[model samples]
Target chain A: ARPRVGYYFTGKTGSQVLTDKIKKLQVKDFQSIPVVVAENVSVYDAIVTMFLEDVGTLFVVDQGSILVGVLSRKDLLRTSIGKQELSTIPVNIIMTRMPNITMCEREDSLIDVAQKLIEKQIDALPVVKLTEKGIEVIGRITKTNMTKALVSLAIDGLV
Target chain B: ARPRVGYYFTGKTGSQVLTDKIKKLQVKDFQSIPVVVAENVSVYDAIVTMFLEDVGTLFVVDQGSILVGVLSRKDLLRTSIGKQELSTIPVNIIMTRMPNITMCEREDSLIDVAQKLIEKQIDALPVVKLTEKGIEVIGRITKTNMTKALVSLAIDGLV
Candidate 1:
């Protein structure tokens, strides 16, 4: 029965309430600003941008500013050890290209994104927005964001 | 007054129960196996080991099997871009040495470690054990683990 005068028993357990609160969390509420680079940029420049921005992941976009691929520190490290020159190699040749990219939207549930990260064993996910032109990279959601979410949940009653 | 039957009110709110459960989570419950490299190992070899082990962070230990330094993917990536040959440079030269390494114990609260990871802006932490010889790396806790913790918390009632 519905509560009357705010004094009725709700019958919901503590776990149920916690689950409700966690489920309500959206990617937009905890996502960080994204850092991107052009697809034509050299792998060397991409690494430099990664260092300057201090991000583990970088989204690769085309000249029209549409997300085309993704780059990770692991990908760069592997290519650096090879015989090819870092400056001569374009990031598009080595980047994880589209259709293989894992992405989420601002309105997606944080838990669903968290599960994708774990299942895919990836470091970060691009929070994207679909457009008439193409998909646009709007935000970034990494394990760091998930960790922050856990901390906030414990520190506060609701996230 | 306490109820004589099984209907006594505990007077704890849902958030209180959630907080208590989250606070009780320990590092040992979610940590992954630690990956370590010898201090004398070449940076190139260390990167190879990292890829083989498939971990973002690697602990560097001395001849006595004591934790001496920590190597991150960022460290190796930065060195890879330098003029120096990665095969010739010892990891100890590029690794973050002792007294600066952020670590946690097995019994430590997961929430506390999560805070350290965010505060230090690092990728992972070694779960250590103090012996007469030195600190032994027993486990590893990363943002991935924190993400897993969050997922578990939502999937199950308590984690």
Candidate 2:
């Protein structure tokens, strides 16, 4: 029979156990609905969609809904202030393209994704699924989600 | 003498210990340097300042460095797409003015600020000090800082 005591023996310190629990958190568990824009959409329309969706970053998709690029508020703001008209400019020309976009899988650890965001200095990452055609944007994870994760841990121990 | 065992006897459980540690994290420990722009600066200059500073939010202040308003990338983007000239329009015309802004103090708990960020649907908060003159911007706390806190907790157990 186990001993009844104030502390339960788990072969790990309290902080170590806590670290393990947080490290196991997966991106799928906290990801948000991904807001996407078609590659051919004008920068103007994309901005409108961002406002309507109330998202900071947008995933750009091709006609087949294949991930092609990523658009951030900074990207749009830069173009908006440029000499060119926003409505006339397509998003593909200004967006961070596929090879340059940082992405993650739904099953990836939230900690790893957080590190990526910090290392890349990006605001968000698309939770993606690789298929026969191309990568599909299944969800979105941003610092907002990370902040919520912290709050949940403090409030509920992430149980 | 304390018992030598796999788990030392503490009144709190592992999760409770972790929760208490995180709940006690202060804004001053994780805050970033605030980037501010004069209220009289043009929207164009503000955008440039945001890019140069590499921050998503900028604090708006008066000549005496008293905080008067807040500017977010979303706020700037909306104004950028407007028909009006960016360079000619001042930031005060579009900023989220005082009394409507969400703020925090350096001594405030990080968890509380994270909750406020989620509740208000805002990305950043100005860490302010109330002086005889008015509010002064001392630091900036954003989702980025919260994310960093989460990462630190995982990597170092916040030790």
Candidate 3:
């Protein structure tokens, strides 16, 4: 079993817990809706559906719950922007391979977490924790939260 | 002047305008705070204070309000973890310089957003957009939003 999660709202605390706070960021806030596709999902259909749903990211998973890879709208858009016969392509080709994405536990902190994003340069992180059942994802944190917090704290005097 | 920021949760319609969702997965989230440091700030003290603040990411900006580069926790952690006693080491040395990190606008669809945390295997993404005044940060996308969305949609059926 994994540990329970914790949250650090900047409104309640000062900036002293920034590093540790990052450890607590999760995927729970803006996961959108799970649009899981099989490994053999057609790239053409994925891109078409991407726009239809107005979603920018897709998780490519297997019959099991284990994470296999992720596909971004940019990947499909970059590929299909001008192509006409690209719909039949499989998502595995463009999706980010697994073991490459970072997973966080529910109880991690958002503090000092900015370094991980800066190092990788990607926009989002996947939150997970190890358990007897395996790695279970609990939530997510988006840069949007940063923008909100920055503005909030700046107005509240942390700037 | 900056736009008037507001926090209004999007019910089942979702906050993201065009992003794919994770399936049956819960992830971690973070409250990404935007903190800036001057170009001349001491790298040594900056690293120390950043850790104490527990924020993994820091923005290095100029007085003109232009974001120049980003410094991550790993950048400083590497120095501290490796015993790189070069205390005077500048953040510019280890930072993942700008024009390399993928940035996005707040109004953009979360569905098609790139995975900044996944690529670097880090936890956050810095959000910046072009404006008349210069480049300004709007928000960050992290794993936490992803987790929450997954739980709400895939596991909880909120989506």
> Distance from true position, residue A25, model 3, in Å?
6.5
Local error of candidate 1 at A79, Å? 0.8
* Winning candidate number (DockQ): 2
Give the DockQ (C-alpha) for candidate 3: 0.03
* Candidates 1 and 2 compared by DockQ, better number: 2
DockQ of each: 0.85, 0.91, 0.03
> What does candidate 1's lDDT look like per residue over B1-159, in tens digits?
785765444677788889888999999999999999999999999999999999999999988878999999999999999999989999999999979999999999999999999999998999999999989999999999999999998888666
Over A63-93, each residue of candidate 3 has an lDDT whose tens digit, in order, gives 6655677776445544543333465678887
> Candidate 3's error at A22, in angstroms?
7.9
Across B1-159, the per-residue lDDT of candidate 2 in tens digits comes to 877754456677778999999999999999999999999999999999999999999999998999999999999999999999999999999999978999999999999999999999999999999999899999999999999999999999994
Report lDDT (Cα) of residue B142, candidate 1: 95
Q: How many angstroms is residue B145 displaced in model 1 relative to the true structure, after the best TM-score fit?
A: 0.5
Question: How high is the lDDT of residue A12 in model 1?
Answer: 75
Off by over 4 Å in 2: A1-8, B1-8
Report the lDDT of model 1 for residue A108.
98
For residue A140, model 2's alpha carbon misses the true position, in angstroms, by 0.7
lDDT of 3 at B90: 67
Cα deviation of A118, candidate 2, in Å: 0.7
In candidate 2, list every pair of residues with a backbone clash: none
Q: DockQ ranking from best to worst?
A: 2, 1, 3
